[model samples]
Target chain A: MPLLAEGSFNLLSVDPGLVFWTVVTFTLVLLVLWRYAWKPIIEALDARNDKIEGDLKKSEDLRKEAEDLLKSYSDKIDSAKHEVNGMLEKARKDAEDLRNKILQTAQEDATIVKDRSKNDIEQAKVKAIREIQELSVDISLKLLGNVLNQDVNDEEHRKIVLRELEKLKSSN
Target chain B: MLSVMNSLALVFALTLAQAPANNQGQIVPLQKVESGVSAKETSVKEDGAEAASADVHESAESFDLNEVINHHLGDVRLRDFYIMGYNFPITKRVAMMWVAMTLLLVILIPAARSISRNAAKRPGRFTSMIEVFVTFIRQDVGENTMGHHSRSYEPFLLTLFFFILFCNLIGLIPPMGEIAVKAGELFGYQFHLEPGDIPLPLKIWSGITPTGDLSVTATLAITSFFIIQISGLVYQGIAYIKNIVPAGIPWIMWPILWPIEVLGQFTKPFALAIRLLANMTAGHMIILVFLGFIFQFQQLAIIPLSISISVAIYLLEIFVALLQAYIFVFLTALFIAGSQHRH
Candidate 1:
């Protein structure tokens, strides 16, 4: 009680000076902080938010574009595979037709060569028989003439020998 | 946690230092009473005689708890500033407000620079921490309460929050006066002084909460009141005057309801001022009262109980300091928002 009386202190006593100082101090703090601190910080926060949102949207678009490209590439690969299969099928059919044509031509040439050689052998045999018969008629006429003292005709003997040889070939 | 420990140490040291000075004034009568009682006991040592002496002793020892509480809570006029032929008294609370203002400027200006520099990048730890508090004040308190209009008022709200917060937090730390006294005592220099005898340099960095002062809180509340009223007038125009009574009331009841509703506007800020003042003062009062118990009972057994309870209350005071600052700003924002709209 003595200290309170001596200091003249009261809990609810109003002090106008303290209030004036507080107002001045608070106003200064508000002005300094508002100018240097709050404005820039809020702007930065908004900017960072916008940048993040834009980056997210850009990434989403890139992902969709990549997906589209992948689908188109896969479609191209599928068509190429189909074209390759068709080309193989056509090549195989062409090779088969060429092979059949070559085999048929070879068989025909072998048959023709065999028939021509058979005809040549038959003509050669007929000429050789006709020449042998003519020679024999000349030698027999000469021997008979020497025994009976007379000559025989060569043309009629040759003709009669060729005819006999032909008859013999036909009969064989 | 270290600051809290330092604060506890300081509080204990302050109690120990003040104890002797306090005893010099208070314990002399107690000693005289004891001698008288002992002299009586030597002649006739009866139970009734001892009880009567104990009652007499209690009366003789004058430890005024109200005086101590008031002396600490009340503002001390440090000096007078003369301007324009008028004197403005500078008190301890005013100096404390200057301290809070200095701290705000010193700490927040650099933080603001860092934030602006790092707007496109991540900020440093300290800057980011400051940003977190600023963001909370803007987004949670200002934006949540006032919506888009909060942008214009964010500066005022932020200043109020930080200013009150610094004042409250600074009060929790032992005042420069106590620290100086304790430091002097540690070096064998003793000071036996009253609350007013504390020197100006030591007194300027006040340990007392400015918000604990009714004048200071009232000033802040008055500011908030103006902002609320101005916002109402600006947003709602002249209709704001009529809108205070709310809509859909009977026209006959306007005379009755209008006066009470008009008074409600003043009472809202009045409650705000008182709420902050009481909350800030109560914690310190409880702590002081608990510490006062040691001297009152003059028992060693009560020291541990008193100090432990004081420490508990001191910790609670820290929490209340933040909570009260938050509550003051949040309510102001709410009131401003409320005023701008009808109902």
Candidate 2:
């Protein structure tokens, strides 16, 4: 056995010592492996998983932020259009009021000129009628005076001449 | 000469127990071994007819190393009751086996203690490495081998792989470091020391690879073989036996392929066991022999060649220690996987 211990090229055989040791070694190794090795491997994987999830969430948040910024920009554009429209409507209303005031003053001035022109025409017509009536009566009286060879200027003189003429005709 | 005689006698005593030898001296003459060379003559006598020399020659052409190796195991397996006898020495193998076990307990228990639930971070390097290996085995081998109950086998496979790895590594180291033993005991027989009792073999560094022995390897192979068969039987039953021959064989070819398939099953694991033993064992021996050649062939011209060869082989042996461990684990996984398959 001691000679055997001095390792020679021995052929394959079961050394009882070798078998016994193999079993004992196996048991001890199994125990260590259960506790130290497998447990840590699982833990590391789980940790890595958590880290990946957190990264995904951060990306989602950034995406949402981008979306919000886009929405705000669109809303600003919409309100600008509404504001422009309001200003245009106000300007149009102001222009319409100015036009209406000028029309009202023009109508009032036209009415006043028409009234003054009608009053002047009526006054002229009355003056002409009075002149014609006075001229006719003056001519008739002059003719009468020539034919009768009498001159009458006042009302009392005329009345006496007429009475004297009438008495002479009656005696004839 | 006395030492040679004793070695001869030791070898013979172990051989005759297996079978009876005829007048021609070949035991178990029923079958011819793979080589055509007949194992007829055990002893060599120099014949004048063969241009004989006085120096004894070990016949490489005729002898089988396998037979001689098995011969060393003796009658340990034959006895109904477990007894360690004069021919069989239990004391040596047992003591060493226990020492190996103790070493395992001492090393692993504390390493396990360091791992905890509150370990907010991962464990230390060794612990993390172990974890990675466990996960790999669990995913690759365990799930496939054990199915839904893979975790159950995880503990067993992981433990077995490391245990075997550790033992093989230990075998490669010199058991007793520089402390010289003036004398050593063999099966209660006190070996006398002439000042320095160490043999050239033991004094040199040898590590504890147990697969080097046939008995050790055979036992391991046989155990795996039985486990594989039993699992197959339970999982696939008679259909499992049918699948062992593979599906495409013509019914007419069944007779020939049948025995071969049975033999093949045993052969694969046998090869696994022997391969591990041979690779590690041969590497160690090559290194030993090379170093031995250094002094044994003391001529000046041979010195450089011997040292160079020995150094080269030594480097190769270091790689082998790791290689054997991988092979054993891989083969074990393969066998387990094959057995699990039904079709």
Candidate 3:
């Protein structure tokens, strides 16, 4: 049912009866409830809502911390890779240097052995050449003397002895 | 299949038969007309009146000893009462309102005492339900509207919201209707519960719904309007006038924007009054219509349909009870907020 005053612009026209009791009723009830109901109920409700909001804040903070940790691990992983590469490169360079030093030592040792053998051989050859040539002449002479006794021709024996004496002199 | 249709047919037949019964037993001044016809007249009048005045005059003829209550305050003859007199025959609503308040206190006082009786235990259904409602309004409506910015008004708003709720809820109870009408009755037995076979309005020997009374609603709305503006003025002082005219409007546009802005301020509170008055009044009319059927039919056979409609309406009225309360409080807050806040 439409309860409005029709065709009137008396914008504030209202049924006085409804208004008066509403105020009375409202006042009485408000007084009673203000004392008992309003305080505890509102307090409890605000407390409950505050608790829920607090929990939500904690969850958000935890989520942020987890993201930070995840970022740190990722950064650490990159740096670890760099450090390992640097160590690997240093190890490889040291290995190459050690190998070169070892090779140089072996070459120096080989050179020493070669020079000592050549020196020894040279000394031995210089001392032995004269004596060996003289010895060979004396031995040949003895052999020829034995052959002359058996069948020696005087002229060939003299020529052989003279050639042998000349050859020995030139060798000395 | 014929029976199902017949059953529906049976229901209609019963409704038609019962329709005349509610009207039959009803006594009217015009004897020759017979309730058969005169009752129809009352029904039509009641319906039209319902549609027109609705809850506005619901308590008018129902209030008894109304002059005595108003006499204490001095009614129309007294110039102040005449000019700004309280309407809605304040006696019964005031009394009933008292009763309801006492009842809530009675219920809550023992309840409060008992909360500590079971220390550490949460309150039970009634207590807890009251708690939940109080808390919801406190945080959602009260705090949100006023904020900590104005703690002074928080308690006031909270009070307004619940009081409106109690009035609305008490009005919904069928007995309270009779109680209200009974309180105003001059001739009939005060405690008669549905006296005759025909449904009867509480034989109010005289009076009306206080909230339905326009004078009362206007007083409320106007006072609230004053408070909204004055407080805005006090808080903002001379700047409150700014609410009547927008700050950034072009100088040439003052002619257009000024009136509208000014009218908006008054209308905000006007809407609150009408809204509260309307919601409260509308509920009674709905219940009356549903009850009118039983009297119109005169047959008991329509009980099923009547009961069905009544129950459905009652369930809906419960919501209206709370909704009207919230709307009243919200509008008050909105008007208050608008005036206080810039634009």
Candidate 1 per-residue lDDT, tens place, A1-172, comes to 1211223345576677787888888888888888877777777767777878888999999999999999999999999999999999888888888888887888788778877777777777767765666566567667756776754456675567568767987899
What is the C-alpha local distance difference test score of each model? 0.74, 0.51, 0.54
User: Tens digits of per-residue lDDT for model 1 on B193-249?
Assistant: 443244444467646678888888999999999999999999999999999998999
Best by lDDT: 1
lDDT (tens digit, per residue) of candidate 3 on A1-172: 0111111222245435535555656565666666665555445555556767887899899999999998999889889988999989989998888888888888888888888888888878866864665466455655666766554335576567668777877899
Candidate 3 CAPRI assessment class: incorrect
List the TM-score for candidate 2's chain B: 0.62
DockQ, prediction 2: 0.09
lDDT of 3 by residue, B35-104 (tens): 2123333564565634444452342332222211221111121011232554244333444455556666
Q: Which of the predicted structures, 2 or 3, would earn the higher DockQ when compared with the native?
A: 3
Better of 2 and 3 by lDDT: 3
Worst 10 residues of 2 chain B by lDDT: B27-36
Question: Which parts of model 1 are misplaced by more than 4 Å?
Answer: A1-9, A57-172, B1-17, B20-22, B25-63, B84-86, B188-197, B298-301
Candidate 2 positional error at A43, Å: 9.4
Q: Considering every candidate listed, which one attains the maximal TM-score?
A: 1
